[model samples]
Every structure is written in C-alpha cells, then in structure tokens.
Target chain A: AQSVTQPDIHITVSEGASLELRCNYSYGATPYLFWYVQSPGQGLQLLLKYFSGDTLVQGIKGFEAEFKRSQSSFNLRKPSVHWSDAAEYFCAGVRGTSYGKLTFGQGTILTVHP
Target chain B: DAGITQSPRHKVTETGTPVTLRCHQTENHRYMYWYRQDPGHGLRLIHYSYGVKDTDKGEVSDGYSVSRSKTEDFLLTLESATSSQTSVYFCAISESGQNSGYTFGSGTRLTVV
Candidate 1:
C-alpha cells in the first residue's frame, strides 16, 4: 500500500515570502509523485509531477518540488508567494502499475497575508 | 480544464433516500474517478472506471456504487444516504496512462439530513 503524509495542516506566510510545504511518501518502488492545489469551492488543479528524471520539477504559478528519494519526500517550494496563492495543497503518489488511482495525503491549508 | 462537470453542484437529501451523482466529461478520457472530500481527510477515492462498463472499487467504497455505460459519463450512486456521507464529491478524468495528470471537476456538495 502506498501512502502520503503531509506534516503541516496549516501554514501562514506574508506576501513575497518564501514558502515550503513538506510531504513524505511510503512506497515499495520508485513512485510517481504529484502536487495539487484546490481553492475554496473548486476542484483540484495539478501543480507539478515527478516521474523519474530531474529531482527538481517546476510547476505553474512559480511552484516547484524536489523529489528526494533518500528521504522519501517530495516538498513543494516557492521563492515568493502572492495573496492569490492561498489555497489547499495536496501531495499524492501513484505506484507504477496502477493506472490512475492516486493516494493523497491530508492537505495543507496555505494562507497568504499582505 | 478537461471539460469535466458534476451535476447538482449542491444537493440536500434526507437519510435513507437514494442519491446518484453524475460525472460527465467532454475530453473523453479513458479513466474517470469518484472521490469524496471531507474536512481533515483530504480526498478519498470511492470508485473509478477504466472504460465503458468497467469499474473498480476504491479505498472508501463501502456504501457507494458506480456505473459507466458510456465513454463520457460515470455515475456514483449511494443506495441509502447516511449523515456520514455528507461531503463534497469530486469527479476526475485522466488519459489512459500511469503518468497522466488528473483533471478534476468543480465538485458537488451533498448534504444529507
């Protein structure tokens, strides 16, 4: 069974401040990792994904994630956050065999303040 | 956006009544999934369809059933609504592959009284 763990339940940051959201996964093999964002009353949107190459994967809205195989972690990072970036973030992992089913972690709610 | 839409954006129902939620997609993706989102639990998959008339149970599929008779539609049915079932449901679509990113619908909020 694959599981994703997000340590932070909520985080607050000022506008233009750096942000990092931690995520850890437990899977037997090399897993496919992804980050998704959801606003209130909206569906989730994919931020980025990590398949194999490039430990650091860049995503939309100036978001990026680093897949650290050693630590079993994929942490999302942004140099500067905007107020509009306030949303819920989820980390998910998929085994190589499963077609589309994703195991998602408890999301981290991000609050961006001016 | 993958053209996925969930019907009855908001629904209020009584317990013991049957409720069916519809998920329609214009992208014609091969994979469709039903998930429920609750406070603190994030999103948990209830069911998924790989193709027309082919479906599978997900992690939290005990009280739910699903059907996919066409390529563009997947329906999730709760035989008997329970107060525990009140939550936001989301529909997602993905292409036929392992690495494809999922596209999700806005979501349907169902409240059972």
Candidate 2:
C-alpha cells in the first residue's frame, strides 16, 4: 500500500510570500503523484501531477512541485502567495498495480493573510 | 470540469433507511470511484469500477456497496444508513489508471441522524 504524509496540518503565509507544502510518500517503486486543492465546500481541483520526466512540474495558479526520488518527496511550491490561495491542499499518489485507486494524505489547510 | 455530477448535493436521511447516491458523468471516463472525506481522514476510497460491470472494493469498503450498470452511471448504496457514514462523499472519474489523474465531482453531503 502506498501512503502519503503531509507533515503540516495548517500553514499560514503572508500575501506575496513564498509558500511550500511538504508531501512525502511511501511506496516500493516510483508512484504517480498529484496535488489537489479544495475550498470550504467544493470538490477537489487538480493542481499538478508527476510520474516521470522532468523533476520540476508546473501547475495552474502559479504552483509547482518537484519530484525527488532520493527523498521520496513531491512538495508543492508557489513563488508568491495570494489571499485567494486560502484553501485545503491534498497530496495523493497512485501505484501502478493498484488500478486507479488514489491514496491521499491527511491534507494541509493553507491560510493566506495580508 | 470533466462533466461529472453527483446527485442530491445535500441530503439528510434517517438512520436504518437505505440511501443511494448517484454519480453521472458525461466525460465517459472508464474508471469511476467513490470516496468519503472526513475531518482528518482526507479522502478514503470506498469502491471503484473499471468498466460497466466490473467493480472492486477499496480500503474502506466494509459498510458500502457500489454498482456500475452503465458506462456513465455509478451508484453507491448504503444498505442501512448509519451516523458513521455521514460525511462528504466524492465521485471521481479517470480516463486511465494513472497518467490522466482524475476529475472530481462537486460531492454530496450526506447526514444521517
């Protein structure tokens, strides 16, 4: 079973500040990783995904994540934070033989302040 | 954005009553999944279907059942609704297993009292 861990339960960042949400996964082989964002009462929106190729992957809303095999981490980062970025972020992964089932982390709630 | 819709955006059902949640998709994705999101549990899969009649259980499949009669419709049934089943249920569609990621539905808030 592949499991994901999001070290931070809550993160607060000031407007225009750089942001990074950590994500760690435990799997036997390389896993397909994804980032999702959700507002208070809405469904999840895909941010980005990484399987192979370039280590750095860019996503919408000026978000990006780097896949580091050595550390088994795929962390989401943003150069500048916006007040509208306040939402809950989730890190998920899927193993090859697991079909389409996704394993998600506990999630990290982001709060942006001005 | 993948044309996925979960019926009864919000519902409150009494305990011991049977409730069914529907997930209809226009995207025609091959894979459909049912997940429940709790306060600290994130999203836990209940069941998933790979094809019209092929389905499999997920991690938390103890008290839930799912069926896919058509390619676009996946139904999740709570044989007998319980308070423990009260949570935000999400339906997600994936064209393929891993490469395409997934597009999620708006979700259905089910409350059992």
Candidate 3:
C-alpha cells in the first residue's frame, strides 16, 4: 500500500517571502506524484504533477516542486508568495497497478500575511 | 478546466435518508472520480469510473454507491446518510492516461443532521 505524509499542518508566511511545503510518500516503484491546492470551501486544483523527468517541475501560479527520490520527498515551493496564495495544499500519489486511484496526504494550510 | 460540474452544491439531509449527488462533465473524459473532503483527512476517494458503465470502489466506498451509465455523467449515492458522511464531495475527471492531471468540480457540500 502507498501512503503520503505532509509534515506541516499549517504554515504562515508574509507576502513576498519564500514558502516551502513538505510532502513525503512511501511507494515501492517510481511514483506518480501531484500537488493540489484548495481554497476555503472550494474543490482542489492541481498545482503540478511529476511522472518522470527533470527533478524540478514548474507549475501554475509560479509554484514548483522538486522530486527527490533519495529522500522520498516532493516539496512544493514558491520564491515569493502573494496573499492570494494562502490556501490548503495536498500531495497525492497513484498506485502503479491501479488505473486511476490516488492516495492523498493530510494537507497543509498556508496563511499569507501582508 | 475539464468542464466538470456537480449538482446540488449544498444539501442538508437527515440521517437514514438516501441522498444522491450527480456529476456531469462536458469534456468527454474517460475517467471520473468521487472524493470526499474532511477537515483533517484531505480527500479520500469513494469511487471511480473508467468508462461508460464501468465503475470500481475506491479507498472509502463502504457507504457510497456510484453509477455511470454514460460517459459524461457519474452519480454517487449515499445509501443512508449519516452524520459521519457530512463533508464536501468533489467530482474529478482525467484524460485516460498517467500523464494527465485531474480536473475537479467546485464540489458539493452535504450536511447530514
């Protein structure tokens, strides 16, 4: 069975500051990883996904993540965050055998201050 | 956007009653999924469909049943609504391969009293 862990439950950062959200997964094979963002009372939106390729993958809203196989981590980062970037972020992975089933992490709530 | 829409954006039902949530898509995607979002448990998949009339149980499908008679619509039914089932349900669609990411609907917030 595959699982995802997000170490931070909540993080607060000031506007224009760098932000990083940690995500770690346990999978036997090379995993298909994804990051999703959700605002309050809204459905999740895909931020980025990593199947196989460059370690650093860029996503919408100026967000990016690095897939580190050695550490089993795919951390989301933004050089400078805006207040509108405050939201809940989730990490998910798909089982290689399963067609489209995804296991998601607990989620990390980001609060951006001006 | 994948042109997915979930009906009854908000619903309040009583325990023991049956509730069905409808998900409609215009993108003609082959894969559709149902997921419930709770406070501490991000999102848990309840069911998914690969094609017309082809559906499978997800990680949390015990109290939920899904049907997909058409390629553009997937319905999720709660046999007996319970307080524990009160949460935001999201419908998502993906293109038919591992390379594509999913597009989610706004979500349906169901509250069971």
Q: What's the TM-score of every candidate structure?
A: 0.98, 0.98, 0.97
DockQ of each: 0.79, 0.90, 0.71
Candidate whose lDDT is highest: 2
State in Å the error of residue A107, model 3: 0.6
User: Which lDDT tens digits does candidate 3 get at residues B1-113?
Assistant: 44999999999999999999999999989999999999889899999999999999988999999999999999999999999999999999988745677889999999999
User: Which sections of candidate 3 miss by over 4 Å?
Assistant: none
Q: Candidate 1 versus the native: TM-score?
A: 0.98
Runs of candidate 1 with Cα error greater than 4 angstroms are none
Q: How many Å off is the CA of A74 in candidate 3?
A: 0.2
lDDT of 1 by residue, B1-113 (tens): 55898998999999999999999999989999999999889899999999999999999999999999999999999999999999999999988746977888999999999
In terms of DockQ, the best-performing candidate is 2
Candidate number of the best TM-score = 2
Task: Give the residue spans of candidate 2 off by over 4 A.
Answer: none
What are the per-residue Cα lDDT tens digits for candidate 2 across A35-92?
9999999899999999899999999999999999999999999999999999999999
For all candidates in order, the CA lDDT equals 0.93, 0.95, 0.92
Docking model 2 quality class: high
